[model samples]
Target: MNFNGPLETSALRQVEICDSKLTDQLRLNAIERSRMMDSPNEEVFDRLAFLAAKFLQVPLTIVSIVGDKKQFFKAAHGLPSPYDVSREIPIEDSICRYTLQNEPIIADDATKHELLKHHPTIGPWGIGAFIAIPMLTHDGQVLGAFCAVDTKAKPWTEDDILMLKELTASVMREIHLREKISELEDESQLRDKFVAAISHDLRNPLNVAKMGAQLLSDMDGDEEERADISRVICENVDRADKMIQDLLTASRLKAGDKMPLEVTFGDLSALLHSTVESLQKGHRRAFHFESEKTIDGHWDFDRVRRVVENFSGNAVKYGDESKPIRISVEDHPESARISVHNYGPSIPSDEIDNLFNLFKRAQSARDSKHLGWGVGLTVARSLAEEMGGRIEVESTEEKGTIFSLHLPKVKPSLH
Candidate 1:
């Protein structure tokens, strides 16, 4: 069924009328968090609806949440016809939407009530007496209604109001519990991913080290071959150690502790050059450094190196390996910029914000051949911020991807 646009609320003489698209969207979000839409009727909610109907002396009681397009009857006591079977109705047909302004609606007779006389739930569906208490969130967003309805017009008493209100509170409590449980399940799933990703990343280096050791033992007396094998073993072991160190740094940063740093006067251009040379020795990928002049800043040398290395390592893992990765340094009046650019698929716009978050990875990175625990970027961002710098990224299909670290020329006070 076609659901039309916004339905204007009939102004109530006593209650202030306030409704907007933003408020509606927030209500929808709160409903989503409630996690009640499209769910099969639970015994607890059904019992609550039944209690409301029984106590109020009404034939129908519903715990309904109104969505943008439809109204979902999460729990229904005496709903009739296709609505009872389908458990939902078009948004235009929902009487519960009228109560979304956080106002308790009490209509002794919908046909006589000015606000609801023309409403479809009353006009065509023949709902007479109705009372709905809004299920309001802590932040003031209205999820929908816990309502009772009768076929005959009947005045609601104070006791009926009190009972419905109490049952509505119970419904909200159940919703809050569901929201907490959903959050916990999400956290548990993330933890599982963290463990699996860490195990896969750690196993790679260990296997490399083990194979290198076996090769060294098998090689009979070629000194050059022995030196190369020994270097490989040390590099893999160091790689594993670096991963562990990054993980520790990420944890500390997450705990709101400032990253420990030793600030010293250093040239960013020279640092990038040396970092590139070191990275080149380790991998077959070509890394090019570009700088017109030295850009000096008061920064932690090791921290800067580590951040740049992390960016470049990610470039190798996610970028097109056939093309050379470009590292550029720029000196501005107030700040210096060092950027690592790679020619590859652009990062999706939606994933950019969480790219540096611990245990979060971009879709591109996750799909790549590299197996990372998603901690390197997090540590890099923390180190950059600790050194009075911030990392910026620009990625597009036309220009490729650039991860730039911008640092102030003057050292920032740690205190």
Candidate 2:
């Protein structure tokens, strides 16, 4: 997934590209890592812009990060009314984007300059003279621009351009420092979450198994009761073991490792029908199956079964029990889709993307009377991608929730 930066603006296609770097994903990632776009103006950056304006004698100066949709003003000194208040403008209207070519833009008279003359905001904003210095990281990815603008046409001397360049370096220093700090904080939070999730989620099943064993040892029940307790103990032990395996898998996948898969020919339709039948025996919720007679594919059987069970388990836990949970398999030319759908409260739009993240549970899941470690979806996504597939989800009040896995018919590569 791409980083949708904070600016709520239009698409990057609106901007005329003079440099391919303007659309480079790595460059955009650097900008996102900086975390400077749409952020509150810091005194340190405001001071730099102020000093640039005063030293260069330009009425307006800005420190901006040019994003795909819009240009965000980290600092705007002496900027006009609405733009200063909003701190951003559509990418099509931004003259600062020209600096992404890794060169300083010096337009003495923008109205006559071939490149600046056609931009709509150039005339209305009374930008007669402007100089933009590209803010480049140490690795030479241009983030955006540090520019000085004047209402009246004027020539920039060498000394003035040199000073502005120095200040641009200062801007990049601050951005890089902030990026490092954010990375460190994220690492710390990841460690904390790992500790918390293991300690909390693993305790429930372990305690259940321990209690069942203790009850059996006490010999307070008859033979039938002892057998029941033994079965419960085994089930709880299996549950705990599965949780540990999922935790390890999620951790490895999160660290950018591909999961190992055992590929074999199988019938997806048969897989779903059998899995759903077994689930129906265990769960009170009604299970309905629909599919062609057979949907053949080369894929990992155990991983696919794991995903089916997870999706169906979620449906049983959260869906309205009165309504039947539907499981279906559809065969396409290049791929096959297995969907598990249930009627229940819909997932909120804001929380949908987060559902696949480690330890991220939907609001409905948190509010429901069900217990989950929230690692299932994360591991499911990794397994699907490793098998050259993806998971798609849709939820609405009228349509209910649907979780579908799209798998390639033929294996993409050896695991």
Q: Ten residues in a row with the worst lDDT in model 1?
A: 13-22
> What is candidate 1's lDDT per residue for 279-314, written digit by digit as tens?
888776899989979888787888888998899888
TM-score of each: 0.74, 0.71
What's the C-alpha lDDT at position 297 in model 2? Answer: 81
CA-lDDT, candidates in order: 0.83, 0.83
Give all candidate RMSDs, comma-separated. Answer: 5.1, 7.7
> Using alpha carbons, what is the TM-score of model 2?
0.71
Clash tally, candidates in order:
0, 0
